[model samples]
Target: MSYGLFKKVHYTIPVEKINAVKLTQSLQARITGRYMAEVINVGMGDDGTDQKAFLVLYSSRNSMQNYLQMLLPEFSDILAAPAEKQPRVVWAAWLIPFSGYLVAIAAGLLTVLEFRPDFLKQTVIAAAGMTLLFLLSAVCRFFTAGVSVKEDYLILVRGYMRRSVICVSYDKIQHINTKQNFIAQKTGIQKGNLHLLASALNMTQSVPYFREEELDVIKSRMLKTSHAQ
Candidate 1:
């Protein structure tokens, strides 16, 4: 694969040396059913230790996957299974996350307007307009986000204006967790969180506005992989 601007970076890993072919749904390629294809190859680290090179394919979907499988038929089983993705995003699930922001904005606007009574009326109108726009944006973002699970990796695709597709290995995930408010519980909506490599990376990844059943599927796979590792 070759990719870069002025000077392109090329990669050619032998079929035997290929570690894994990860399929993720980035916002760009997600419009069509077909998505992004990634090639994970073995590389040498700065300290002369083994590392990984995640090379993204500019062209994607079944075509790329088929070519690779033709090169190595042994792992066809893994590639053949379609990526089981939870496409549904609960719009109501975003209410709690946005509540605090709305409150803060209201409070700030009130406080600022109190000091500037001369332009209070105009300021209020402007702030209200901007707030509505932001709220609309948040709604679009929540609705467009997606999450998927695969045998070797878990992919989280979030954000609307600036999308991000994070693919973390199941083995790296230390644990899986979920939280629900009274409303969330009643509605069967929960926010899922993933704690990965407790000692190495003290960070948690989230699957926002996820349905209970879909989240359960991801939780089961994540737990099984983490424990096995």
Candidate 2:
């Protein structure tokens, strides 16, 4: 890729080093049927991760076609398997929030009965309402989230209201870490995160909530893939 107004700059990027491909469409671009894509590339150096960006053809037919051509074969599998309908660990979504809320409700119920007996009914109603909201969030998350390792990519899918799919190439991952807080430890919920070759975008691919064993599967797969590569 080469571009410049006065002094032309040329970039020779390996497909493997390309970490992210983001297409942006504005109101004008939508109507004009022309869009811009950001291609983020990363490489490892003796000092640290080196990241660079390329702005693909903007508002030009040739640029759009070039981007689509690069996008299709590169992420065909991920596109074929859409994130919105991916399978999820249903219980993992509700477990943490539900546990905390249950404890608070139990305490509130006891306090109201002992000190404010007159407000016990009202407290119960409020608790029920709050529980419903938490349940609704869990349902939404269950439908939105997924974590899968396919071929050489680690795909982390999650969001509510808007869907986000994070794609991380296995070769670029610098580290893999897992965490469990106090509540998470009690509830058997864990988080797994990948430290990829650093970039200004700080794009993270992770499984935010899951069972310990589920995270283990991802770790095992990643290690095997890395070693194989």
Candidate 3:
């Protein structure tokens, strides 16, 4: 069973009340990037019994406004942005194979320079192993992956070996993260996972090998899709 865990809750500053332009300008100056936020959802809680507004953000100025409108339908009828506008890359799955290929070629070269017949065998074996690994990784990449934009649900499937499928919905999504390790960066592969509200059923649906950038795109799409009404 898979579940989501709550990591953090970020409160928003009012757009009208704050100096939106000045704040944005400052952020741009300091970070050399544009900033945007979108209001996603709103409702009252036990503390204030007041409606809350949720928003999404983008570093790009134009994209931010568009995402906001998508999240808040009552505010606008325009489509702000696709759930996934920028995709993070996952390089490892792509890298491992290529790395394997390179190593095999290197081994062959070493064999030639050293005049050792065994180098050819070693290179062939290494190349074969790497090629197989790459093939398997790429194949596994698409196996059981699933995403639900309407229900704000996402499912990740890892087949066979330690295989697990995880399912998560927005209300229960605890965390969404993007990570790239040193090796993963070489191939541009980023991995992501979801922490969900804990429960026996959900624990069974937890995902293990999620592609990070793609997952965020799914999340963005779901949140925006939910507001279509």
Best by TM-score: 1
For model 1, give the 10-residue run with minimal summed lDDT: 44-53
Q: Candidate 2: what lDDT?
A: 0.62
Model 3 per-residue lDDT tens digits across residues 1-229: 1122584555654432221110122323225545433222212132453422224333454564565455433333122212221122433454665676778777766766588665677666866786688667655444423332333444443442223223334544545666666766565445555544332222223344333455557667656645663
lDDT for each residue of candidate 2 in 23-60, tens digit (9 for 90 to 100) = 44554564575656555555322235343354565556
Estimate the Cα RMSD of every predicted model relative to the unseen true structure.
5.8, 7.5, 18.1
> Which regions in candidate 3 have their CA more than 4 angstroms from the true location?
1-116, 160-163, 179-190, 197-229
Model 1 steric clash pairs: none
Candidate 1 per-residue C-alpha lDDT over 96-145 given as tens digits, one digit per residue, 9 for 90 to 100: 65787788878877887778777777777887887798787876676556
lDDT of 2 at 93: 42
TM-score of each: 0.60, 0.57, 0.36
In candidate 2, stretches whose alpha carbon ends up further than 4 angstroms from where it belongs are 1-18, 21-68, 71-73, 82-97, 112-122, 179-191, 199-204, 208-229
By the TM-score metric, which is better: model 2 or model 3?
2
Alpha-carbon deviation at 99 in model 2, angstroms: 2.4
lDDT of every model, 2 decimals? 0.59, 0.62, 0.42
